[model samples]
Target: MSGLAEILHDNGFKVQGSDASENANVQRLKKKGIEIFYGHGKAYVDHAFRVVVSSAIPDDNPELVAAKELGLRIMHRSEILAEILKQHHGIAIAGTHGKTTTTSLAFTVLDYAQKGAGVINGGVLYSLGTNIKASSKPGGFMVAEADESDGSFTNIHPKIAVVTNMDAEHMEHYKNLDNLRQAYENFVMNTPADTGVVVCGIDHHEVAALAGRVSDRKVVTYGLLPEAHISADNIMQKGAAMGFDVLIEGKRYAGFRINMPGRHNVLNALAAIAVGIECGVDLETIKKGLMSFKGVGRRFIRIGDAYGAMVIDDYAHHPVEIESTIKGTKGGFANNKVVAVIQPHRFTRLNDLMDEFAACAMDADEVIVTPVYSAGEKPIPNVNREELAKRMRANRIQNVHVVKDPEEFNSLVQTLVTNGDIILCMGAGNINTWGQFIVQQSKLKS
Candidate 1:
């Protein structure tokens, strides 16, 4: 939303917004001179301005009610983003995962090639040093993480669309995998016929089927599989990083290095490679661009190491993401024990995918489940940490713990952790604070 706001602001549109509370994202926007309020209320609404909000906003929100009463124009965040898309030769990165990384990487390539693209990523790009960047070039294009959480990607008719992977997620909003697949299928179908569709070939049959349906849509595929148009070959993991030789259209594209540890990131780099290739960039520039990426905030970001333990934070909430992150950790940190501090994000997701969450989280040497983040949703009857802990334990996962508050969570880690421990904090909520608390406490003790 802030990225779109930046785009509008650059295009001479007055923009202001209200978050439920202030955070890093909001602070970044304020730093850019965008007016932001801490809470939503009728008082924030103005007769002279239009209103834009995410789907998470309730229909009864006071601002919405007031806007309706005033007969002012109101647009959802996706709609406004779509309006911005129409102005650029947009390249949208869409998927259940890896969209942020791929989109950021694509932005980096454009930057290195001097394309001067505007980027709308879901996470903070460490390279750009911000979550968004408004370019000074008119025809430079806009690169965005086209999200499927609310089926909003349907509104973005990009010339180039990339799907990193497809899986069952956002179950609260999507009735089932079929519904989710249909939304993605529609995303591919909705793109303009003149551009490319890069789909992940490592995905399930549903994703492969969706890729097939868009075969006529200038499709170029990628994955670790031999059939992929771009494939990662001769992969090696060496201490919190991965290096691999990339094959594009059956030709060697030299070796690429990703400091962010994960096969997911390898695939993410591949996705960016596909995008760059389709844009007529040479292999050397593409490799240099990919290598130059430092990574994004909270996407396996290393906060610090303390008392012989290394702490990493990631914005992984879905089962596939969690599992892949664990796999990445095992290969990257060869000598450390993986301790997972996971905060489930929303009630609807936890209630729907409890079993899958349990299976994925068991990969850690120790698992700590925090209470659901709520996100303003009332709790479902039996979907809480207590139940989640019970289910994970039933799988014979012995080192499991549950904490509802930050204090106890910190205490548990401070007490149980030792040297050479790899503490990975994962979630989409305030659980990110645990990394800061742990580092602060470690400093005091030192």
Candidate 2:
């Protein structure tokens, strides 16, 4: 929503918003000259032409209620994004994971290739230091990270659609995996038939199936599979960096390197490369753009050093994301012990995928489970950190501990970390604070 405010303000719209509290994004919008209130109320909506609300905003929000009483037009964030797509060549990145990084990479590639692309991402782009970048050139492309959690991604009609991968996410909304797959199928099918191109990661069955159903549009498959139109070969990890050769149509297009760690990121880069090539970007420029990408904030971002150990923070809440992040960290730091500090994001997710989460943490040498971050949801019965730790131990995970308090978790992390170790704090909630706290504590100790 902050990105939307920035975009609107940049386009000469008077925007004012109110959040429950001030955060980094609110401060950013304030710097951009957008009026942002500290709390929600009806007064903030009195002078507004329209009201925009995110998925998290409740129906009873004071501003929302007042807007309806005033008969003001209310719009979902996706509606505004869809309208933005109509003005520019749109490339919407949709998937259960890796969408932000992939969208950021694609935006960077287009921007560097002089395509004049704008971006609206979920996380801050490390290179740009902001989530939204207005297109500098007229009639250029807009790269957007499409959220599939609410099935509203179908509202977008993009020139090119990239699905990094699909998984059983937001089951609370979809009810089952098949329902979620149908949503993705609809998102892909909603693309422009004559000009749309679907770039998908064939490694994921759901995404591969969605690609197969796109008969009227161009479909580009990418991954480690031999049948992929764009595939990576000879992947090598050097510490926190990875190098790989991009193969297009079974031939080497370019050898590229990225500062991010993981094969999933290589797939993400492949998606960006495919999009760039589809949009007439040169192979050399695409390689350069990807190589220059520092990575999105909180996606395995190295926060600081804790007793010579690297403290990394990531937004990995789903089991698949957690497993991929841990494996990627292990691959990058092969010799270093990977200590995972995890805080489950929601009670419903923890209750639904307890076993998968347990298995996801098995790769880490030591696992520290924290209390679940409710994210506004009511707590579930018998779903807590101790039970999760017990499940991990049942899965043959040797060292598992629970730290219910955030302050105590920081102290535990200080004692558990050592030189050459990598403390990977993973979750969607405030677990990144653990990484930051450990770094600050390390600085104090030093």
Candidate 3:
């Protein structure tokens, strides 16, 4: 939403908004001369032409209520973004996971081409240093990370679409995995059948199945598998760095290296390479963009170094995402024991994937489980943090411990940490605060 405010202000629209508290983005926007209230109130929207909100906002928000009473226009964030996207040759990066990274890589490569493109991602992209990078070129390429949580990504179809991978996620809105897959199909089908191309990750069974159904438009397949149209082979990982040889149609395209840690990110880069290829970017320029990408905020991003230990953070809440993150950390820091600090995000998700969550952290040498960060959801019976640790113990996961309170967490960080340890903070909520706080304490101790 802050990104929207900045984009609107950049385009000569007077914009102001309200948030519950101040954050880095809010401070940055304030410096940009946009009026942002620290808290929600009816007065925030008193003189507004329209009140825009995301799916996270509730109907009872004071600003929204005031807008409705005053007969002012109200719009969803997706609605506003869709309008902005129409002006450019939009290329949407859509999937259940890895959309932000893929979108960032695609935008970086296209922007490196010097052809002028724009991007709006879910997180702060390291390449752009912001969520939205608007281009003045109307009808030029625009790369955006499509939000599939509320099924709003179907509102706009891009000239080229990249499917990183589709899984059974956001099931609250989707109701079932089949519905989610169908929604993805609808999103791809909306793309221009004459010129639009669908770049898909065939490693995922669901996404591969979706590709098979996409008959009207061109589909480009990318993955580790040899059968993929664009595939990565001869992969190597060395402590948050990866080198891989790219192959297109059973032939070598080029060998590329990236700063991202996981083997999973290879799939993401493949998607970006496909987009860059569609935009006429040379392989060298594409390599430059991929290799120079630092990382998305809180997605395996390093915070600080304490003695010989390295503290990194990530926004990996789902079981599949968490497993990948833990395994990737261990793979990167081979000699170091990876300590997995996990805080489950939502109650609905925990209730749904209890078994998966219980076993996902098995790769880590030590696992610290924190209380569920219920993002406004009510707590479920017997599905708290302790249960997760219990289940892990039952699954024969050694060194599993439940640290529910802040004091316990602080002590755990201070005493349990050792040299040659990768302290991984993984979650989608205030666990970032823990990561940042741990780093701050380490800095103070030195």
Candidate 4:
């Protein structure tokens, strides 16, 4: 939503909004001359032409109530995004994970190809230093990260649609895995049959199934599987970077290296490659763009050296994401002991995937489970961090600890980590601050 505000403000719209509290995004919008209220109130909506609310916002919000009472236009964030999609050749990246990274990579590739494209990414692209970039060039492309949490992604009909992978995510909205699969199927089918294409990750069973049903449009499958139209081979890891060879339709296309770690990222690059090729970008340009991408914020971002240990922050909330991230971290720092500090995101998710989360953290040498972040939902009985730690221990995870307080977790991490160790902070919530706090404490001690 903040990214959308920035894009609207750049396009000469009088954009002003309110947040519950001030944060980096609020400050960023303020710097862009967009009025940002620190808290929500009815007065904030008095003079607004239209009120835009995200999925997180409730109907009872004061500003939302004011908008309705005043007969002002009210729009969901997805509605605005859908409208924006119609103005350009849109490339919408969607999935249970990796949407932000893949969308940013595609944007970088298009920009490297000298195509002045506009982008609305879910997270800050570290290279661009922002989540959005608005292009003024005529007939240019617009790349966006499609959010599937609320089922609003079905509103978008893009020229090119990329599904990095599908998993049982946002179950609160879909209620079951089958429903989530159907949503993705609809998203792919919504693409224009004549001029649109779907880039899918065939490694995932659900996504591969969706691809099998895509007979009306151009569909490209990418992964390590030989059946994939665009497949990666000869994957080699060097330090924190990964190198892989890409094959397009059984012919080797190019060998590329990305600064990101993990086989999942290699799949992400393959998706970008498929999109770039479909959009007429040369293989060399695509390689350069993938190599040039620094990374998206909070997606395995190295915060700093802390007490002789390297601290990395990542937004890995789901069990699948957590497993993949831990695997990547282990591959990157093969010799270093991995200490995972995790804060489960929401109560509903924790209750639903407790056993999976416990099993996912098995790769880490030491696991520190923090209290649930509870984005907004009330806590579920017997679904706290201590129970999660107990489950991990029962699963034969050697060392597991529970720290209910963030400050205590920081102190515990300081004592547990040593020189040459990798401290991984994983969550979708404010656990990134734990990484920052550790770095600050390390600097203070130094």
- Per-model lDDT: 0.82, 0.88, 0.87, 0.89
Instruction: Report the lDDT tens digits of candidate 1 across residue range 138-186.
Output: 7567888888999988998877888888777877688788889888888
Tell me, by lDDT, which candidate is best. 4
In model 4, which regions exceed 4 Å deviation?
A: none
Ranking by lDDT: 4, 2, 3, 1
Q: What would the per-residue lDDT of candidate 2 be over residues 1-446, giving only the tens digit for each residue?
A: 88998999999999989878988998999988888888878888988889998889999999999999999999999999999987888889999889998998999899888887899999999778899999887768999999998988989988888998887778888998888888888888777877778899999987888887887889989999989999999999998888998888878865699888889889989999999999999899998988888778899888988878888899999998888889988998888899988899999999998989888887899999999999999999889998999989999997898997767877787777778898888899998887788788778878
Output the lDDT of residue 113, model 2: 89
> Which pairs of residues collide in model 3?
none
Better of 1 and 3 by TM-score: 3
Stretches of candidate 3 off by over 4 Å are none
44, model 4: CA deviation in Å?
A: 1.0
Shift of residue 152 alpha carbon in model 2, Å: 0.9
lDDT-superior candidate, 1 or 2: 2
Superposition-based RMSD of candidate 4 using all C-alpha atoms, in angstroms: 1.1
| Candidate 3 weakest lDDT stretch, 10 residues | 406-415
lDDT for each residue of candidate 3 in 1-446, tens digit (9 for 90 to 100): 87888888999999998888989899979998998898889988878888888999988989889999999988999888888888888899898778888888888888878868988888898766788888858788889988888999898778888888887778989998778988899888878987889999999988899899998788999999889999998899998888999998887966698888898888889999999988899888999878877778888888886545788889899989999988888888877888899999999999889999999998999999999999999999999898999999999999987887665776687767788788898999989888777777777777
